[model samples]
Target: MKLPTDHSFFSSIRRLLHTYNLPTAYQLLESPPSKEVWKTKLNSAVDQHTVATWQEDIQEKPSLKYINTDALSVGKTHHLYTYVRPNRIDMLTAETKAKLLTGTYTLLANRAVFNQYAVNEPS
Candidate 1:
């Protein structure tokens, strides 16, 4: 099945980055998560009560900054666009990571839509 918003390729890349490994900052902060804990978190994050979980997860860390959305002006045209605001060194606590992982999985379940957006790379 394909994924929504993106594809397995990006998801795998994220998994590699977030997974408990020698390269992650999490390992430096705490002991590596056990397989059970990882699976449990993944499952819990995607459960029916996801929004609440996401809120809690997001609140876990001291927010560096809130995501901002600004209207982009095309100078030459009247067209404007809303873009995802970025943050520097955004740290995802264990909760956010689980939410992300689960959210991606949920979106990916929609294979047709997932295929449609998977190749839309950001410029």
Candidate 2:
């Protein structure tokens, strides 16, 4: 569950998507890479595109937002990456806030988003 800060965040995002059996990272790309493309390099470009695209995508979907380690409390973000945002922190029930403190809430909440973007393409 740790993200390597030295590399682009999308590399970690792509890894998490696979580890969680989530969606294809290609959806974040303007033009998906070909089979012959070197993934490490292509992913660097995709990372930039993803952040920009996600920022735009959420503009029209106010109910949803992208949450990343940078937005979390320092203690909670050392090993985190992007996930779908939950309800406002101030409005969370005590029990729900507890889950966020424990990281369980993020894991569970992100599943719905993962499924929403999931692809059936063979690997």
TM-score against native, each model:
0.20, 0.25
Model 1 lDDT, full chain set: 0.46
How many clashing pairs does model 1 include? 2
Candidate 2 residue-wise lDDT, 3-113, digit = tens: 657477877787766644444677646566565564655565556556655667666675545555245342243332334246565435655656786667866447757
Instruction: Assess the local accuracy of residue 12 in candidate 2 as a C-alpha lDDT between 0 and 100.
Output: 78
Number of the top candidate by lDDT? Answer: 2
RMSD of 2: 20.1
Backbone clash pairs for candidate 1 read 3-108, 3-114
- Stretches off by above 4 angstroms in model 1 are 1-30, 48-123
Model 2, residue 49: what's the lDDT? 58
> Which residue runs of candidate 2 sit more than 4 Å off their true CA positions?
1-37, 65-123
Best by TM-score: 2
